[model samples]
Target chain A: MLYELWILAISSLVAATCGIVGTFLVLRRIAMVADAISHTVLLGIVGAFLVSQTLEGPLMLIGAAVVGLATTYFIQVLDNAGVPADAAIGVVFTSLFSVGVILVSLYARDVHLDVDHVLMGDISFAPFHTIEWNGIPMGPQAFWVILAVFIIDLALILLLYKEFKITSFDPALAAALGIPVTLIHYLLMTMVSITAVASFDAVGAILVVALLIVPPATAYLLTEKLSRMIIVSALTGVAAAVTGYYTAKYFNVSIAGCIASAAGALFLIAFLFSPSQGILLRGRQRKKAAAPASS
Target chain B: MQEWLQFLSSPNLQWVMAGAALLGLASGVVGSFVLLRKESLVGDAMAHAALPGICLGFLVFGRETLALMGGAALTGLLAVYAIRAVHSQSKIKQDAAIGIVLSVFFGFGIVLLTMITNGSYSQSSGIDEFIFGQAASLVGADVQILIASALVLLILSFLFFKELKLLIFDPLFAGGIGLPIRFLNALLSSMVVLVVITGIQTVGVILMAALLITPAVTARYWTDRLGVMAVLSGLIGGLSGAVGALLSSTISGLPTGPVIVVTATAFFLISFLFAPQRGILFRMMETRKNTQFVLNNFLLDTMYEKLEKRYAAGQYSALFSRRELEEQTRLPRNGLEKTIQALQKQGLLTQTDGKYVLTGTGLAYAYDSSLLRRIQDIHLTHEAELGSWKEASANGDLRKPRDYLMNERIHSLLTAEQKLPVSLAIKQSSIEYADQA
Candidate 1:
């Protein structure tokens, strides 16, 4: 039960961190780029391993930042060279990810990295890897790492709320107003990279994508204001984390995968039933709008 | 190389390579349309979405390949619909919709996969094979399916080539021309789904998109014509498949899907850097030559203008020293030096006692350059009247301004606007008088 609580805490922190950062990505309409970053950060982990022989240091975050930025850089290169946006994203991420996969198979054989763990992470073991200071046991290492990430993300988002809001809504206006649109974009990307890597040990790379995109997307359907949306997105992520934990426990399935599925389920509910933007309500409004004309 | 050739000669190896090649060919052909339609990542979303369906099929029907493929197709099509629904039904954009559907469905699929792994199903072990594909496990029946799918894809693409071409390039025109745009779009999406279903066995879901995008994009660098691009894309995809299959088979412990993706990306990188006309290397060289040409023209124009000013001021000794030329052109010293050396090598500049003057041929060339500049000035000043010329100039053939001046309509328009240069105006009247005689 204690382990289950630890897993739930870690997963919620992971989801909340992803939720806050992913809000910016969805607003900028670069959710696919986030997906690409999620995939290619595997290469970062492998690279960090190759460099430092471990995946448990600040080197992992640094590697993820470098590779995540490189993924966007390569995509920009292809875009400037006349490749369409989707094809540029598809090609860059896949190629880099394939290289990562090949490297893992070749050099990281002694390590405990496998494709399965990379796809669907094992959060149940989060309790076992506890952090120690002065012979006293702290919480799980993943919990602390993700908590630090969550705090940093929330603080940054709070500090730069106006900058993020202005840049995301109208980049041209932001540039005209001297808001440093490109810098804000890269800053957001860095935060996303850090959050993704921090959540990776608990939720895996792919489910991190789910937690990143699905919660913000669900919140997007619920609210129109950026501040409310961030709050709603984080809340939705926490909700999914809690519910998904129990669901996974009952079914004896992957906790991270179940959390992602739970996030998706929440999105479906919000999509079909949100007061301002639900599909059923919109369809009814459309019918009412058409009735007078038909009559 | 000898060992590779011997390995290729083995019958089993040949069969697997052929199967992979066919899969690659089909994906490449269909992927061309998908890439041109800007739906390259839809194949990726469909591939991920097919996982749960495959698991559901295995749960229900045990291990029939046809049933599994059917299940994959159903969910794949469902994912497309879901993406469309999310995009159109709300304020969420297409990219977010695709990401949401892709990751969520894959997450759900992982849940099912974990269930099957932990379940008491006897044949659950092989189900994981669909995740990271094992090309070595492919048998003759799978190869036969690949062959048939490849044939069907080729034949349909051939039949629909004209409509697909029109649809991708100009959907509005195609719709105005009464083509069934919706049906054609559905046909293309269905073709993508078919490719994903057939390909998941060889390349898996995660990297399946690379097979669809890399070859198509690589082929795009080498061709502008759609028909040629599609054919080239198919051939490149086939080659990547055959090569990747061979390498993975020979390489012990290497996964086939990533190996195949690496092979396709290798082709993409090669094409990106070195293909002619559109390749990065060729573009860099072309840009360099253009810079040189622009510098050359600027130097000649500046020299001609300065010499004209001196002649007008009645200074016959109008030769320019290198320092004066550099100060006048305002170009950087090294570029100025290079341009001067090139002009001298071309015999367009003659040096006398550390001073430079244009040769007779160089004088004529400079005169034409000035005349072209005058015409451009007139065009810009009288842009409203010269709107048609804007389109013509956009073709970038301004090497001979005299040809445009000779056009009676342009000449009369320029004269009416009083925008013609004095020299060209007199020359035009003389030519008109000569034609009258």
Candidate 2:
């Protein structure tokens, strides 16, 4: 039971990191990039496994970053060369992801890199593979790695506080002020790629893609500042992960789907009931304001 | 390639191609308004939000087919109405509103999918495919449904094009002209919902949204005229759908959605590079020519200055060695030498014994009054140039909007209540322009 709690904590922390980075990605209208990166990482993972003859953490990260950066570079190149933003994204991400799918089939058949794990992740069964550290049980390989990543991301985001704010708000203005807008965008893309690949092992590919965008976007509804948005998104991500986990167990369904659905459901509730902005509440407020004027 | 092309030319592939073409044409036509209004992602939300409708239809009939589509379209229309109403009554931004509706509605869909999968439903596995399409699985009935939907959409678009254009181009003028912007918005959103529902089978909900936006965006590079843009967008989309279907069928293990999207991107790349006025190749060539011309004139001026200094020194020599000229003028060896040779042949300079000197005409051209005019013609960002009237802010101040517009010269063009915001409040304001603008 205690071990199960540790697993939950480990899972939540991993989700929180994705949520944190995804906030700015969605705000920058690059939500699709996050989607593209998550999908493209499969190719990277497969490629790394084929080359390195092992699935070590750093090798996967390097492979994923290379593919992810290539995805971003190719996309910007397409757009710069004349492709529409949406179409360029679709083209570059799709092509790379297709290559990834092909590679997965050709190699790594022995590994559990099958469609099911690719879709929903293997967290429920992740606890079975435990490692011992300092003669104490470390539940899964994902636990320590995810926790470290979460802390690193939290610190890095805090460190670059002002620069992220300016760039996310208005990149053109930031550029005019000589804020190294290109470098910042690339850094953000790199961070998105790292977080995406990390979360992929815990929450499956598509669910991670959906969660990264959905939770952060939901947080944006409740806050104006980027700082507040990051905090709110992390909270929403952790909440959604826990709710999704237990609910999936209770109902005996896909945990990734439940987590994604829970995040979506939370946003819906926020949509209907959020003060000042929610659909129903805003309609009522509009009426209340109009009543005095009509009289 | 031959075998692939042969497979592509088959009757089944042809049907799928035809359906995709018609669907593409409809989206391009409808999506023109969506993009122009910068409400593009409204399609994304509508697609996600339509899932519950399919489930409801499934719940009613216990299967997945055309009926589920109608149910989804209806629910999609409802979601659009909700989006419109929320924006109208509240201060929530469009993107946030889209995100909210998209997530919540999709949340409901997940819950429904769970129930349906848990129960006895053959369509469960196939239905998930609607989130990521399989173009190969397109059957005759599906093609007919798509064609019918496309026709219906086309007819509605034609009936409402003028009104839709008016609303998108100028909402206030449209309202003042009594074109019913609200109803027109609903009409367009309904059209969007209809297109998305039909597209789900071929491109899934997520990728369907991409198809809706991608072709239209690609079309934008080809033409600025709304009508032409819509037509081009349709052709690109149709070609993408066909080519994507072909590519996926030929390849052993390619997903249809990604293939279609990649094909659409190919069209975009072609348009971006080859389209007249906007192509990067044309722009680069034009810029290079302008730069070379500037370099040429600067070379001529430097030559004339050397002549003037020599003339001041009472020297009559019309020739100087390459070594002396190289010291006199700082330019790269090969290109400069080539330009000098070219200029000498053009009578702008005289090359005698590998030395070049300015001609009488070249000397006059160096001090020509029209040089500034020629430079100005090629000056990019001339408006923002240094020492311009705008930079110094010391001109007639015609740049100021209030001084120019409401300063009695255009008073006769306005009615009594027209200039209220300008004079009474003295407010500096602008409508938050859409992202497309």
Candidate 3:
């Protein structure tokens, strides 16, 4: 039970952090870029491990952040060079991801860098890897890493709320006002990379995309204001985490997959039932408007 | 070489190779329309969305490949519809909708896959193969399925070639022309879904998108004509599949799907750099030539204008010393010498006693008031445009200039300093154009 609680805490923290960053990404219409970043960060992790010769180090996050930024830079270059947006993303991420896969298969086969684990992380065992502070147990290491990322993300978002808002809404205006829009954009991407890497060992690389995109998308469907959207997105993510924990327990399946599925299900519910944008509600509204005209 | 021939002659390897080639051809043909429609990643989303259907097929009707494909097709179509619905009904854009649907469906599929892995179903052992694919596992029966689907896709695409082209390039115009645009769009999407289904078993869910899109994009670099692009794309995709299969078979531990993706990407990289017109190398060369041509023209125009001014000042002699020409045109000596030589070679100028004289043709070219008038007209129009833009900017209307002034002639006539504003205006206008579209 204690193990289950730890897993829940870790997964919720992971989902909430992704949710907070993802609201900005979805608003900027670059959630898919976040997906690209998540995939390419795998190459960074492998490179870091190859260089540092250890899986447990801060260098992995730094390496992954650098590669993630490189992916964005390459995507922008390709976009400017006349490749279509979607195709450029597809090309860069897949190529980088394939290189990462090949590298792991060839060189890191003897280490903990298993491609399968990179694809589908083993969150169930995360509780066993406890972190210690001066020889005192501090719960699971995964939990602490995610908590630190969540706090950092929350603090940054709070500090840079107005800047993020102005830049995402109208970058030209933000630039006209000397907001350093490009720097903030890179900072957001770096935060996304850090959050993705922090949660990678718990939710896997690909599923990290799910946690990043789905909850925020769901929250967008539910609310109009950014503040409400962030709060709602975080809540949805936490809800999915808790519900998915039980779902995985009952079904004896992957906890991470279950959480992603739960987040998806919540999005569907909001898509159908949200008061302002719900499909059925809008249909009824249309009918009512037509009925008065007909009468 | 003998061993390679023997390996190629092997029956099972032959079946896998044939399946891959057919799948590649079908995907390429369909992917042309997908690319033109600017929905390249829609194929990616559909491919990922097929995962849940495969698992549902296994859970419902056991592990028959056909049944799984049928299930995949159904769910893939559903996902496409869901994307469209979300985009049309909500404030979310198409790309966001695609990302949302893709991750969600694939996530659900992962959940189901986990259930299968933990369950007691005996046939579930090979189900995970759908994720990364196991092309070497193809048998005679699977090859038949691939062939039938590929042939159907080819025939349908051929029959609807003109319609697909019209729809892809201009759906709104096609609809205005009463072309059943929605039905045509649905058909093309279904074809993409079918291609994804057939490809998943070979290239897997994630990398199937590379097979579908990379070939079409690669072929786009080789030709301007759509028909030629489609055929070349199919050929390129087929070649990549065959070569990838052969290479994977020769290698010890390489996964076939990644090998295939890498092979296709290699083709893309080569085409990107080396293809005839659209390749980077050709574009760079064209840009260099254009810049040189523009510089030469600027020098010639300046010289002509100076000559006209001298003539207006009552100088009758057509010949002028190089130093006089340089002083009048304010040109560097080396550039003036080169331009004079080039004009002389073109029979527009002649050298006499260290002086440059205009030939009859050169006189006609220099006195061509139409060219002068055109340049003046361009300058006047640009000044007018600049005035309006300044007024608009002052009025706090931040909208950029529209695309009415992107003429290459105007671009060449502008000086280096003038080109910056023109290019910036073009960029802003093009962005606005894309946004409106």
Candidate 4:
């Protein structure tokens, strides 16, 4: 039972961090870049592990952050060089991910890093890898990693709230006001990279994309204000994390997959039933508009 | 080399290679249209969306390849439509809608896959290979399906070549000319779906978009003509596919899908750096040459002006020391020497007693100011015309006067309450403006 709670706490923390960072991603219309970063960060982790010979080192996060920034930088370079944005993203991330997969298969075959686990993380076993200090158990290692990432993300968002807002909303105006728009953009991508790496072991790389994009998108539908969107998205992420955990336990399926599915389900609910932007509400509004004309 | 020949001679390897090549050709052809339409990632969304369809086909119709392909095609088309519908109906933009549909459909597919694996389906064990693709597992019948589908896609694309080109380059113009644009769009989208479905088995759903867009983008660097780009893209795709297959066969445990994608990326990198006109090397060369030309022109014109000033002051000899020339041109010492050497080689300058003097040819070239003045006059007139046109358009002076009367009539037809609020807001704002004045 305690194990179950730790899993829930880790998953919720991962989801919430993804939600907070993903709010800006969605607003900036680069949510797909988050998808790209999640995929390529695998290369960074595998490379880091190969060099450091340890999975529990800080090098993994640093390497993943570097690769993540490299992905964004390459995508930008390609875009500036006349390749379309989507094609650039498609090319860079797919190639990096392929390199990572090949590396895992070739060099790291004896290591714990398998392609399957990279694709679909095993959250159930996360609690067994506990973190200890001074011979006292703190919590699951995954939990602490995500807790640190969550705090960093929260602090960054708070400290740079105004810069992030202006840069995301209108980069040109922000640039005119000397806000270092490009620096802010890279900083956001760096945070995304860190969040993706922290959540990767728990949710896997592919589903981490789902965690990063889905809840924030659902929150976007539910609210009009950015602050409310952030809060709602974080809440939605936590709710999905808890519900998906229980659902997966009941069904004996993959926990990360279930959490992603639950996030999608929440998005569907918001899509269909959100009071202001819901499909049903729009349909009713259309019907009401046509009623007077019909008479 | 002998081992490679033996491996190539194997019938199963040949079949896999053939299937991969054909898949590449079809996707490359369809991908050109996708790239031109700026819908490159739509292929990715469709690929992810096809997962549930694959599972559904397995659950309902067993593990027949044709049944699975049909199911995947159906869902792929559904996903495209869903993306369109979501963005069109809601406030969601296209990218967000794509993200939504991709994750949701993929997540749902995972759910179905897990359910099937847990259920009593004996053939469900190897279905997970579809996630990363296991081209080695493809049998003879699968090869035949790939060949037939690829051929059909190629034939259909060739038949509608002009129409596709028009749709890609200028859809609004195509619509203006009374073409069946909506049908053409639907046809092209379905063709993309067809290519994606056929290619997914060899490259997997995750990397199928790479096979679709990479070769096409790489080919774009080598040519400007669409026809040439399409053929080159297809050839590059086919080559990457064959190479990837051969390498995967030679190496143990290297997945064919990622190998193929990496091979295509390799091709892209080579083209990006090495192609003649559009490649990075050539672009850099062109920029260097342009900068050299500008610098040379500025230096020569500066020398000419300085000589002219001396001539106007009654000094006929257009001679100046290297230091004086450098001061006049503001060029660094080495640059001044190089420019003077280049000018001397071109018979535009001469060195007499350590002083640079303009030759007759250089003097004549410098005196040719009429060409520059004419170019400046044309530019000035063009700017004036543009300015007048913008003012005229802004003031509505070029519009039909009757259009304004019609607009005013429509405005008057609104209810008094409707007009009152708008007029009141205008009045309030104008009153504030008056107070500020």
In the order shown, the candidates' Cα RMSDs to the true structure are 4.5, 11.9, 9.9, 13.2
Q: Is the docking of candidate 1 incorrect, acceptable, medium or high quality?
A: high
lDDT of 1 by residue, B1-437 (tens): 99868877888888778988988898998899999989898889999999998998988998889888998998999999999999998999999999999999998888999998998988788787777777777778889998988998999999999999999999999999999999998888888888888889988889889989999999999999899989999998999999999888887777778888889999999999999998999999999999998888899989877765664565545468888998999998999999999898988887877878777667667767876777777777777866655676777656677676775656765543233334533443353344334
TM-score of chain B of 4: 0.84
Q: Write the per-residue lDDT of candidate 4 for residues A219-283, one digit (tens) a residue.
A: 99899998999999999999999998899889877788788889988987888888888899878
Which segments of candidate 4 are over 4 A away from where they belong?
A286-295, B369-437
Task: State each model's CA lDDT, in order.
Answer: 0.87, 0.70, 0.82, 0.83
Q: What is the alpha-carbon lDDT for the whole of candidate 1?
A: 0.87
lDDT (C-alpha) at residue B172 in model 3? 84
What is chain B's TM-score across the candidates, in the order shown? 0.90, 0.73, 0.80, 0.84
Compute each candidate's TM-score over C-alphas: 0.94, 0.79, 0.85, 0.89
Q: For residue B156, give model 1's deviation from the true position in Å.
A: 1.3
Q: Give me the displacement of residue B165 in model 4, in angstroms.
A: 1.4
Model 1 clash pairs are none
**Best-performing candidate as measured by lDDT:** 1
Could you tell me the lDDT of residue A39 within candidate 3?
A: 81
Clashing residue pairs found in predicted model 4:
none
Show the colliding residue pairs in model 3: none
